[model samples]
Each structure stands twice: as C-alpha cells, then as structure tokens.
Target: MKTKRGKIPGFAIQEMMVVLAITAIVVGMAFSVLNLVQRQMGSIEDIYEVKLEANKLRQSLWIDFNRYSYVNFDERKGQLYFSNELEEKNYTIIEDMIFTEKDTFNVQLEHKAFYFKNHEKKIGEIDAIELKTSKESGHQQIFVFKDNAPATYINHKP
Candidate 1:
C-alpha cells in the first residue's frame, strides 16, 4: 500500500528567533524615546521653578526700591536697608522687613571702587541695571531691569 505525504510550510525555529530579535529592537527604541521625554520634562520643570523665583525676587526688589528714598548696603550685617531718608526711619529695610522671612533670595550691591566721572546718570534716569544670579560656577543668568519699568530681560548663558 502507498501512503500520501504532506509538507508543513510554517515558520521554522530560525525565523521565530529573527522575529523575536526585531521585536526586542523595537521595544528598546521605544524605551529610549520614553526616557528622553522624561528627562526633558524634568528639565522644563526646573526651568519653570527658577523663572518663578526670579520673577518674585525682581518684583520684591522693585517695590522696596521704589518705596524708599535710598538703598544702603550694609556688608557687616549682610543686609540691604531702604529708608525714607538717611537716619530718619527707625527700622532697617532688610529682606525680612518687607517680604517673607524665607532667605532663598538675597541681594548684594556691587560698588565699583573707581569712580566713573562720565557716569552722572541718576538711578531713575539710568536705562537699566544688570542683575546676575548663579546656580553653579558655570551656570549663571544675567537679567536686565529697566530703571523705571517693571519689565525684565533674561539672558541665560551657561
């Protein structure tokens, strides 16, 4: 008696291995993209926090500066004092005097030892004041505030 033979045409072991390898590659690529997105989200959050803090500081400074007649930087006390007139106000205008007690933001006056004979512009008449803050040795931001306006120009140079 003659018996009929049939051939199976399904995927072999090698083909299954190849398909698994391709799937692994695709999954790895997907994970890599997910990681990149997460990192970017973290960076954006950090940037937003920094910007918010800067805005708050700038507003506080402008208000205090405008309310008082003069700003005196006391290096010994590590504080800034604003008074209606020198030796007139009994209270010293430090950070805690006007705003919240938290000391996250501190302002220090930089006085150039050499006098600029040509620089006769008064504080209000001056175009702008350059303020700088640093997060680290290499990371810093330079902000420019108009003398009479509340607008601020932020320059982030890292």
Candidate 2:
C-alpha cells in the first residue's frame, strides 16, 4: 500500500470500508438490544402499577377492619359502614369502583362475601369480608377481618 503523501503509509480504502461496516453492525446490534430492554421495562412498569393499586386497596381495608369495632353492610344500597365509639367510616361500592371519604379505588370485583362469626350473611353486621378482584394479569382475593366484636355490638339488635 502507498500513501498520497508519498512518505507516510495509511489505511487503504478497502480497509476503511471494512472498519466502517463493522462499526455500523455493532451500533445496529446495540440499538436493537436497547430497544428490547426499553420494551421490557415498559411492561414491567405496568405490572408494578397494577400491583401497587392492589396493595393500596388491601392496606386501606385492613386498617379499617382492625380499627373499627362494628362493621355493617347494606347489600341493596351497596354501602359498608365501620364504626367505633368515637367516629364512623363509610365505604360505598358502585360498579367496578370502591369509594371512601378520602380516596376512591378502581377495583374490578369478581365477587364479594361477608361473614359474621364464620356464618355467611347477605346484608347486615359482619366481622369478615372477602373480595375477589380481577386484574389484567390475573385474579386476586383480598380478605379483611375484625378479630373480636364488641359485646355491645354483638348484643345489639339491628
């Protein structure tokens, strides 16, 4: 090989083309891998969002179940009431959503069951609740329970 400068030798045109081609191929492969990783991250983000929503719903229900001494539900009105000695809390269910005084949860319910002392009840006082929710990934079941009913609550006739 000879250079245009006549004294110093340099890379030939064929060698330069080979290096450029290899660089382009490597860059192309890197871009493809990056694209694949980006798509996977997007999907993972969506799954995390779904799981977060589920956890929020579960925690809220658990807190209310444990804090309240009395729990009641009106099936016809789609209203759930939780009460202690001082304050009362209400939860309303309409369609695929659950609404509280503070926030609303977008949960698609597949089924719901209420129980009092291990006996299933349709409408009225309850000690436990089971919710079967539907999500994009799969179905999930959430159960919230009150440990012991207050004597006055259990004795009261409603």
Candidate 3:
C-alpha cells in the first residue's frame, strides 16, 4: 500500500485583492491620524507663543507702571514711554514685535490705547487710567488711580 501526498495550497487573485484592500485601508487610517496630530501640535505651538509673549509684555508693563512717575503711549510709533523726574524709558512695538528697554519679544498685538475717567469732572482730577491691548484686552483691566494724583496725563508717556 502507498500513501498519497497533500497538495500545496495557493491564494487566488480574489484573495490577494482582498488582502491588499485591507492593508490599504489600515495604512490610510494611520496616515489620517498622524496628520491630525501634526495639525494639533502646530496649533498648540502658536497658542503658546502668543501667551508667552503676552506675559512678557504684562510683566514689563507692571514694573514700569509701578515705578514711573508718568506714563504715555505713542500709537503711530507703537511705544509706551515711561518717565521719572530724571530719566525716560519705553516699550515699543514694531512689526508685531514688542521691545522694552532691555528685552524684546514677538507678539500678535493689534492695538494700544489709554483710557481716562473723570467722574468728578474737574480739571486735573482724573480718577482712573487704563492701558488696553486689542488682541487680548484682558491683559489690562481698568486701573483706578487715587484722586488728586500727581501723575498727570502728559501725551501718553509715563
């Protein structure tokens, strides 16, 4: 008696097409996920840059606002000039870049302005002063200074 050998099986064209289609689907899904992650990372980076720059501006301004005897702003020059009895310094913006006397950073600020409130309606009786930014208006809230303050408005410079 002789024993019969089993035949080697091979995949048909339809079976091969099915495998290829499945592979394509998996690879396509992977690529889509990768692309989404990259986009998210870029967005996160942009937001972080904006925040970092804004913080720098706020910190520098806080110091200047406290120390200076006077404060002023120049819209065309994009400068916040601060002054004392002896010296004058400034924080200027150029080409979306902010520059202090010693440090500089890039930001997306669109506007600079000063607001004064005169509830008493008397000459040299300004009760409040506000330094505002356009892009992130929350950076500077309305600051109420004391009445009869010697810090008189002098053309937007401090």
On TM-score, the leading prediction is 2
Give the TM-score comparing model 3 with the true structure, all chains together: 0.58
* Global lDDT of each candidate: 0.46, 0.86, 0.60
lDDT of 1 by residue, 47-77 (tens): 7776666566667656655665444443344
Quality of model 2 by C-alpha lDDT: 0.86
Worst 10 residues of 3 by lDDT: 119-128
lDDT of the structure predicted as candidate 1 = 0.46
Ranking by lDDT: 2, 3, 1
After superposing candidate 2, which stretches have Cα over 4 Å from the reference?
1-5, 150-158
Candidate 1 Cα errors over 4 Å, as ranges = 1-9, 83-103, 106-130, 135-158
Native-referenced Cα lDDT, model 3 = 0.60
Model 1 residue 56 lDDT score? 65
